[model samples]
Target chain A: MSGKGGVGKSTVTACLADGLTRLGVSTGVLDADLNGPCMARMMGVKDHKPSSQNGAMIAARNAYGVPVMSMDMFLPEDETPLVWEAPSQQGAYTWRSMVEMSALRELLSDTDWGDLDVLLIDLPPGAERFQNLADLLPDLTGAVVVSTASQTAMTVVSRSISMALNIAEVEVVGLVENMSTMVCPECGYKDRVFIGVETVEELARRHGVPYLGAIPFNVGLADFLETGRSYIEMHAEHPAAHAILEVAQRVHFWLKNQSK
Target chain B: MALKSTHGPFDGSMSIVYECPTCSMQTAMLTNRAETQMVRSLGVKIGGRTAPEEPMETLRSNLASGQEVSPERPAPSTGGKCPFTGMVNDAIGAAESEPEKPVWTEGALARIEAIPGYIQPMVKRNVENFALEHGCFEIDEDVMDAVRGRLGI
Candidate 1:
């Protein structure tokens, strides 16, 4: 949601959605990444398209009945590119076109979303989109920031997280460090392919944000997504899945505590 | 809207505008420092994989019900001048100092392309413009626009 692009926001989102569903909690994954929506493919529901009902946009329901809507669904084809400029466009288009195309307002208001226990909005990367979401819906609950352990990623993400907290005035729930390391299944050896995990936790603690957990760099996830089935469902014992479920439980319980 | 109280303890509502002349990209951050921090804090929750349900849900629902969701009206300005000197500083000051080096990845362009629709085009254009301005590559508009459009720009 609050991380730079390609930092695995969608993967984490999918896992949490699956985790919640596994708990019998009704959930909806709203893709607000209007400029580029790929949740359909990541969720293994690439062919599902959103429909309209009684002037309200209908979200595409996954096999598990989780309602999903994204820009990818409306795109003519996966290969076609979106070339519109950020500040300039013609014929009822603007940077706002991206948000409007997502039908974010309608999706939130009109859809049956059917008494959702949780609705995860997959916001685009960077501060600008999140800032727009802030202006569009100011009092919406807090945000989660994603970061890699690299210093550059941390620096940019720090500014982003600061903007979310300081400029948007939203509560920061926690931090998730993705691409931490890869653990060899056969040898039980942990490899630090990218930056070490400590950097992320240190940054989170320094900024006073909760350090949730890390997702190791796993090639299996790519294969898992291709099959349209979550690794958790198949490899419940996978360390990566275990880490994800840990964060999911913490997130669930944290939300419950916030309500109280 | 009338220029609201510019004098005294500056609230976290100052507007900032940035113009990158080399590539012709200008953006503004209208809200103040405090608000940015708040948003970033909320982003932690967002990035951490949790949703803020109660307050946000209620606010969104109210807007859905056609309620006017504007904040309380700002106070009228007294036409205050800059306390520093009588001469008003109308123009935005110097841009934030450039970082010592580029922060973007070398393969950022290819990475953007892998994303679903139009985003690739959009980000690619910005990157090209950035590269041209910094002298990383030569500028060729006809070729650039075409390449940019390929990204769906």
Candidate 2:
């Protein structure tokens, strides 16, 4: 899953992994968002280190038994937001991007992911940065682009979809319109809280991509999500959880079709 | 939904999020750093880097309303000026200073020229960048192949 920053890409990723795991599907969550790898904290494995065996790295399994790997796992306590300066010979080409790309490549290839039904890679949001991983994983089933139900988010997400389809040359499976509405659990009042030029369905239709439903605002989600607990497990009966599960099902069906 | 982001991703006015690590700066599309704290207070981690402290009210007002932050610094320039078009260019790549230009063999120059005119400058710059990166003075078929692979052209 990938999209512009602050698009709930990580939350969606964690939920997918959690949902997929519950369905008896072997899953792996790859935290490809090198700069700000929220997966570690979100997966409730912030300090979980990937064990080095022989010369290869082994991904750490989270509480849900979902094997997870992130750039954060490789860093020491003090070093966060890995700052690596590219040499002068390399056109100020953010050496950190290249380094993180290499690290991601190594993580994807070298890590003993072991046979899994799917490996959900949570990617950083950007055209060029996301494109860096394009050559590494050419056989991607498709990308699930995430965005909030807002014009600014959609604009950046539009670029993400274009890059995935054109530059990265990856199939865009669908778009997730997050924060579609905030429902008052007490009064059952619905409010379209975020500012969006058009509905997410309209945005998807305009882009010629599949419109995977939207995730509503859960009043408890703010504090609940910070707990690092899987959303599906925490709020199995919540409307938000239902939406995520449905999205996961669509992704599964899409993957199955791609395999066929 | 719960994990607050400094200034929601969409403000109907912003499109590009700037992530500058060195200066510990980050701007999301229309969101500026002045509101970084308010965004953080909203429980949204703005960037991996900590934002330098500023007035809370300004940040609060900006985050609350998605208004443009005051006294905002202008964005960084592209710096990549085109040699042929003279417009800001990324295709042309780093301009070659006299001391830095690698010596291209006659065969390599011929090979480079043989490429279509429209793409020659880009290919030449890419090849030069590749050569400079690898510290290769000579452009053999192997070097040419490496450059092609590196540039994916």
Q: Give the Cα lDDT of each candidate.
A: 0.59, 0.62
Prediction 2 TM-score vs. true: 0.59
Worst 10 residues of 1 chain A by lDDT: A85-94
Q: Write the per-residue lDDT of candidate 2 for residues A141-216, one digit (tens) a residue.
A: 7788888877788877888788888888888889887778898878988888686568778878888989887888
Clash pairs of candidate 2? A222-B2, B4-B44, B6-B39, B14-B30, B16-B29
Score every model by TM-score.
0.59, 0.59
Off by over 4 Å in 2: A1-3, A85-94, A222-229, B1-153
True contacts kept of 2: 0.00
